[model samples]
Every structure is written in C-alpha cells, then in structure tokens.
Target: MASYFSRRTIDFLLYEVFDATALTRYPHFEAHDRETFAMSLDSVTHIADTLMYPYYREVDRHAPELRQGRVSVHPKVRDMLRALGEAGLIGANFSFEHGGQQLPELVNACLGYILTAANNSMLYTGLTSGAANLINAFGTPDLQSTYVAKLLAGQWQGTMALTEPQAGSSLSDITSTAEPQPDGTYRIMGQKVFISAGDHDAVDNVVHLLLARIAGAPKGTRGISLFVVPKYRLEPSGELTDNDVTSTGIYHKLGQRGTPAMHLVLGERGDCHGWLVGEPHRGLSYMFQMMNEARIAVGITGAGIASAAYYASLAYAKERPQSRRLNEKNQLDAPQTPIINHPDVRRMLLFQKAVVEGSLSLLLESARLADLAHVAEGEAKENYRLLLELLTPVAKTFPTEQGVRSVSEGLQVLGGYGYTEDFPLEQMYRDIRITPIYEGTTGIQAQDLLGRKVPMGGGKALQLLLAEMTQTAQQARTHEALVPYADKLEAEIERLRTVTGALLPYAQRGDTERFLMDATLYMELFGLVVVAWQWLKQGEVAQQVLSTRPPEGDELAFYESKVHTMKYFFHYEVPKTLALATRLTDPEVLTIASEKQVLM
Candidate 1:
C-alpha cells in the first residue's frame, strides 16, 4: 500500500519544532505528557489506518444519495464516525469537563492532520466537534445538556449553518428568521444552502449551530442570533420528533461527496423550533469561535491532501523508470533511470515537500498559539488571542490556495497517469479546490488580512507576528548553514512592513474598494513570506540537530532533507516576492470597475 503521509514529519513538527510536551506546563494541560500525547496519536493513527485509509476511494466512488428527502452516505462513514467517537477523538481538544482528553491543541491538530491525510472525504467528525464546541462555550446549561455529549460522541452530527440562499458569505444579509415564542424557543423559518454534512443518515441527528435574525431586531449583523436547530427535537416526554426541518435536496459536489451537503428548509410547516444560544443580536460573535476553528481545520485539510498527493507522486517517481538521464543519454547500457533521477522531477518533488511541510509548520504554530490563548493568564492570554485573530485568515488561505497548486505539481510529476483515476492525485486536486472557499474565499480572506487584521488594535497584531518571525530568524542566524535563509527571512519581514505601510494610506483615505482591490494577490504574497518564515523555523531546528550529534542513515537524511528543502523554498520560491511587492506598491489602479469598460 502507498503511504499517504509522513508520520516522521508530524513527530518532528509536534515534538521538535513546537515542543508539544512543553504545553503540559500549563495547568489546563498538566495531565498530558509526551507519553499521553504519543498514546493519543498512536490510537488515532490506528483508527485512521483501519477505518479511513482503507476506504478512501470506496467512499468517493459511492457518494451520499438523497431519497425521499433523506440522505444516506456510504456504510463505512458510519463505522468511521463510531470509531472516532468511541476513541474519544472527536472532542480531543475540548476541556475535561466536556468529556474530552483535554489534549493540547498542538497534539489535537496532529491527529486531524493524520486523519485528513488518510481520507479527506470523511470530513464529518470535525464539523461535529466545531458545533459541539459552540454549545459548550455559549449555550445555556439546558442547551449543553441537550446537545453537547451526543454530538461529541458522534451519534449526532453538528454543522455551522451560517450560509443562506441570499447571504452566501455576507452574514449580515442572512434572511433566516427566528420568532420569539412563549416556551423560550424561537420559530425558525428560512432556507440554508451549502451546509456541509447538513443531512446524513450515518448519525441519528444533525444539530446545526444556525445563524438567523430575530423579529424587530437591528439590521445587518447586529440583528443576527444563533440557535441550536436540530433535525429531531426532543420533546418534554423525552421522545424525538421531526422538527419541521426539511432536507429539500442534496448537492452533488465536485469533491468531499461522502458527506452530504444539503439545501435545508426550516418551518415549512411553521413548526421548526430552535433554542437560542447566548444572548440576542450577538450570534455572529459566538459563531466566530467555531468559524475560526473550522478555518484552521480547513487549512489542515488542505495540507493533508497535499501531503498525500506528494507521497503518491514521490513513490511513483522512485519506482517508475523512464528514459535515461539528460547527462546519461549516451549510456544505453545504463538502461532506463528512475524518474526521480531527473532534475525537473526532483524540482517538483522538492516543491511539494516545501509546501506540505511548511504549511504544516504554520498550522502547528497557530495551534500552539491557540493552546496558549486558552490556558495563559492576563496579558499573555489576550496577546495570544489577538495574534491568533491576525493569523486566522492567512492560516486559512495559504495552505489551501497554495495546496491546490502543490497538488497540481504532484500530479505533474506522475506525467499522464496523474490525470487518470488510476492515481489519487486527480481526486486530491479536486478535493483541495474547495478549501480556499471553505471558511472564506481567497479574496475574502485577503480582505480580512490586509484590510481588518493588519490594522486592528492600531496594528498591534502584525507587530506581534513580525516580532515572532524576527525571533525565529535571529535564532536561525546562530546556525551557519541556515544563516543565508535566515537573512532572506529578515529581509522579507521588512518587505512586508514596507508593503503594509504603502497600502494603509488608501484605507486611511476612505477608498475601501481601491484599498482591497488586489487583496487576493496580497494574500498570496503574505502567505509566501509567512511560509518562508516557517521554513526557516524548521531549518533552525533541523540545523541545531545536524550540527550537534545527528544520527546516521534515514535519521541523518531526515534532518539534512529539512535543511535542503528550506533552501529550495527560499531560493526557488522566495524570489517571487519581488514581482508581488512591486505590483502591490505600484500606483496603478486597474481592477476597480468604474463604468468605463472599453470592451463592454
């Protein structure tokens, strides 16, 4: 069987780069040591090996089907969800009070990376975990009592039901209405489209942390409220009954088809009941908790798929012999050389490694911050939270946008076979396309980064991030082999600062559209620089080991490979910043539509 991911790399990032065991020093994570972390990782890996990896293709070949307003997915998904729930993996990152392992976010994220690498098609439990976390955070005792456990146990699925037919990403424009009723429940009425895992038969219930506007409330986002809208509502007598939530239709998606994406209608019979979460008009604030978590998870999914694609192509390149090498063209007696011997293939393979590992490092950095934000006290907590807010969109966008390209490169390494279904790259390419659009589209994430996050708190978040990146560079400067890459990273920080300084004036001048016109490109540039910082950070760790008592054989190759890939990312990938920064700073105003299209 082909290996879908690198467990060794996962260990290096978790234990070496991020220092997962150090998180146990926090009181909240005091119970976890490396042994516990290892046990959890090993258990999840076994579950992934048995349940998810083996059926990656079988689930995709047979997708969920909607019949008579009910959706049924592949039978294996039922087993996978049960195994995840039984193993207590669904709520791995939750607190002990919530019946979770109370594992550090750093460790929890690695588990997700492993599972997603095995089979991204079975992305069901993550939604449930996010939804349960919402109720745990904001819901009343009764709401939590009713929903949290079952959802976490994977008996009932959970989803973020934010998108509506009218308001796709515009949360303020959502038309779903919730009318205050006498029994402390709201009567929900409207349609929600593109709800992932919205309706599926693998679980007994699907609980939606839905966003809707209450009657006579303020307009736009301030009027929004969150509710626990379940498909089967529990009655006073403890019997489950239909809650007037209809599965209007199921979307046959381009990928991630194992879980049903549904078009749902509530209160079709004027009987849909929803219990309010938190206070009125503050729904958007509460939902951001889950939304941000899902954003990072989507980033993991992107990296995971890219990792799988990289290995698939890497294995193929090692075994598949083609024409003789360019230098060995005259050596007919040399026979055919492994495609890996070719320089171009090597370049592509190096690129896939750079993106996959670099992206994982970036995500783990965010996960570490998340753990800190959750456990640290006073100023430390607020600072970690703010830094997380700044990196969320970038974290969500970079792996996903670049992962699509990285998977495409992996496909290229396999030549014609990559396009055919005989290989997994084609499916990986299709699967990763949806990630950039998962939490938010690339353009939206860019606007979030350059427009809001960059300037928020008078630019404190960006300042903190730069300080962090600079610290990594300074540490790497001590290692002679990593000095050059460290220097380039330091220079890139200044370029980022200069670029930000140049762009803020448009926003200060009140030209919002003009300020965000090239936001997507800005996102691309920002992702590349941040990922370069991540590469250097990894190189710093690998360099310290190699310079000090590095082992022989595969162990030596592993550390050396880390340094080599860091150089590849800097030399081959970092130069593009010149073009990006140039275009970003240029005064040309081209993309904004102003009733002056010459072609039209």
Candidate 2:
C-alpha cells in the first residue's frame, strides 16, 4: 500500500485536469517540461519519505525546548532543512538567476502538498522560501547579497515576525518601533509572540522579516515598515555579533510541536539592528504580497493534513473489521464485516474523500492561477491576479474550517483508537485546528473575501470568477452524467449573485457592520460554488478520459472515483448554500452591534 497521500490523484489533477505541462510554453518555464516537474516531485517525495515521514512521531514526541536561552528542536529538523535546501526546493519557484530552478508555482505547490501530508511539523522551507522571496523581490542588492543565499540554502532560518503581544491580527495597532541611526540601520525594539521557527538553534542564524513603525511615523497601518532583523548580525569585520534578539519563551502548542513557536524580545539591550527591506510605511502592502502566498500555502496545509487523515482512516476501516452491515446483522454468526461496508461509515468516508480531494483541486486551481499571474502580461495578468485574489481567502478558509470537520470525521471512523495517542488521528485533529487560525482566522478571511476582494475593481474579480465557473460548467455539460451537477453549480452561481446584490447596498450605504455581518456565510457559499467548479472541471477531464482512453484497473477506478466524488460534492455539499443564501438575503439582522442590547 502507498502512504497517506495518492500520487495518482496528483497526476490526474496536474496532467489530466490542469494541464500543467502547457505552462512550459511560457519563457519563464520554457526550459522545463513534464519530465522536470516529475523530477522535482520525485525528489521531494523521496526526501519526505526518508527524512520527514519517519520522524513524524519522533519530532512530535520530543517537541522543541528552550533551555539555556537557546531553542533546540529535533535533530532531524536540521537534516530536513538541509535536505530541502540542497534539493533546491526551498526556492523551487524562484528564478534560476536567484539560485532556483524557476519551477512553476504549480509544481512548488504540489511539493508542499506532498511534504505537508508526510509530516506537516516539518513546515520550515515554506517560511524560508517566502522570506527569501521578499528579499529577492524588494530588498536592496546589498541586503540580498548578505541574506538571500544563506536563507535559501537553509544555513539560516527565516521567519515572518509580525504578531505582537498587543496586536495579533490588527496590524494597524502594532507598536513595535524602528528608530533610525546615522549608519542607515534602525534600532528595533518590540516583542513578537507565536513566531514560528523564530529562534531555532538548528540554523546558524534566524532572519526575521519583521514589521515595525518608524519614529514620528503616522498612526495605524500606514506607519508600519518592513525590516530584516537577524538573530546574529554580520559585521563588516566578518565577526558575528548578537543583535539583541532574545528568546523569552517557547509555546507548548496543541500540535506541530516539531517547529518552535517562540516569544521573542528584540532590543532588550537597545542594540537590535534592523535593515529596511523595501520602504517605510508600506510594510503592510509588502507583507500582503507574502501573506497571500502564505494563505494559499495554509490552504494546502489543511487539505494535505486531511488527506493523510482520510487515508489513515480508510486503511483502518478496511483492515479493522468490527461490525456487521445493516443487511447482514443476522449473519453475525457467519463473520464480522469490515466497517467500510456500513452505510454510516461509508458516508463518513465519502465526506472525507470529497473534502480532501475537492479542496486539493481548488488549491491547485489557485496555484495554477498564481503561475499564470507570474508569467502572464497585460489583461491576462490582471485577470489571473484578480481571480487569484478572489479565490485566496476562500481557499484559505474552506479547507481549514471544513478540514477540521473532515479530520474529526476521519477520527470517528476509527472510533476509540482514533481518540487515543496510539493512532495518528488525535494529533491530526489537533494539528488541523490551527489551519483556520493561521495566515488569518476564518472570520478574517470571510471579511477579506466579502469586504475587500468582492468589491475590489468594482466587483470585476467576482465577475471574472463567475465567468470562469460558467465556462467550466459549459464544458461539463457535454457529459450527461455531469449535466445535473453542472446545472446545480450554475444555479448556485445565480443565487450567489442574488445574495451579493442584496448585501452590496448595505456596504454602499456605509452600513459596513450590517452588510458584512454574514460575510463568513457568504464565504462558505462562495467556497462551495468555487470548489464545485473545480470538481466539475475535474469531472470533465475524467469523462474525456473514460470516453477516449478508457483506462483499466486502478486507472479506471481513479477516473470513476473522481466522477463519484464530484457527484458526492454536489449531492452532499452544494445544497448548504440554500440556508447561507437565505441568511445572506434575509431582511432581519441579528448580529449587528447596536447601542441598545437585546440579548439580556
């Protein structure tokens, strides 16, 4: 049997469905083809199997600890980081000029899916890659020369240090200050909590892409600036000096204990040196660039964890025979049946399958758009950008919010053993609970989708997304088996429009609270429709394969399974939009805050 995830499914989504090879037509990816993509995937898969999966439990059992003012993680953390960097996967999507393979984001996203599924606690490279990319994109040549190479090579760890004790998600309220000096560097003074991989001793230095406010800067988010604050500063004399960044404490988290989430204190000695990355007071905008990428990565994390949980449960259900089927209750004397034969168990399995695969499909779609956004020009680029922005919040929220439920259901399939530490489900349940809260919480994502992205460019993003969904629905109409699902998706789109039309007037009238009260529900409805589009797109590909190639054995089952899951999403998940639509359009308001209280 294979591991928790399925490579065949990845191949189906990449080659058959998304046509990732076609991306090679662009000059940025011209040197690569399917062979190169497969090489990258195989390389990461091997590394994950050898260096990551084996330590999934070992790392969790021995979580990172802060002793003697030093944060020490599992020894394998160093090995894994070195392996990923040596493999050129840390900066996989970067250009060859910057020491990367110039692989498409699509391929990089698949690599993330594979690695996270194997052992999510080894979530080190993505942070490093993101931080390195920021430097590559906006840092000065001197800064890039000093930091990018070591960071990407895994000799140094990279972190996004944005959260503070005072400001968690509200960047506008951040009080971290960076004061200018005659030498052009700023003195950084602040404390950041929940900083992942912030102060690990596995690497020689930890580079923080931190956010702070310059002296005499305006209030709110407009005053924030981005800085490169390293744990160990490199002097012109080539001597490494402490930059006054200290590890105050380490958080004992519910899961993902392999990576240290540290409480860091900067400028305790008032000697923390910080170099500006791009510009002052544009930190929020600059961070948004990485934040969007991180959001998609978070979505993949949720989906990957759920995929592992689903396979674990599926394997257990097949092997652990405990109950008789409803139709075979009297045949208990004959033999015990596999729980998979039970209707309720089967429903749970389908739910997991639908969520895990559908979420992956949607994430891949977003990744493909990201790739296009990178290579495209003119309106093509704008369209890709808008669509990516529109789908990002939904992509981040849906898998996480629903992934938590899906993992819980996967645990239910194993009954008592799932709850025990003897099995992986308990850890998986704890691990996935953080996804919804990562990058941004579900409520924040909903607000982003509705409040910002939905109205951006005068609603062009939403319109373009609907057009794409319609195009997919049109293609799906060719298969008789898919027509009903396609029609259902189209209807959902219209209902979404009706609900949006109802809500926008409130936003127009400056009644933001009233308008966005049910934004999370809107996000739910929108995510369902978007994933329905992904499933239909997949079904279209599967139908073509079944009609044209007619694969046999596992191949045949794979395509058929895609169609089955597409139907499952439509039948089981798509109808939830009804209540969401009603709530979005209902005249009565229950959540909006008012001067007069009614709850008492």
In the range 1-600, model 2's lDDT, one tens digit per residue, is 247799999998899888999999999999999999999999999988899888887889999989988988999899888988898989999999998999988888899999999999978888898999999999999999999889889899988999999889988999989999999999999999999999887899999999999999999999999999999999999878999999989999999888899999999999999999898899989988889889999999999999999999999989988757777778858788899988889899999999999999999899999999989999999999999999999989988889999999999999999999999999999888899999889999999999999999999999999999999999888888788988998999899999999999999999999888988899999998888888899889999899888999988998899899888889999989999898888898777767775677
Q: Rate the local accuracy (lDDT) of all candidates.
A: 0.91, 0.91
Error of 2 at 337 (Å): 0.8
Which pairs of residues have clashing backbones in candidate 2?
none
TM-score of the candidate numbered 1?
0.99
Residue by residue across 176-239, what tens digits does model 1's lDDT show? 9999999889999999999999999999999999999999989999999999999999998988
- True-vs-predicted CA distance for residue 539, candidate 1, Å: 0.5
Root-mean-square deviation (CA) per prediction: 1.0, 1.1
In candidate 2 the C-alpha lDDT for residue 159 amounts to 89
Tell me the deviation in Å of residue 559 in model 1. Answer: 0.2
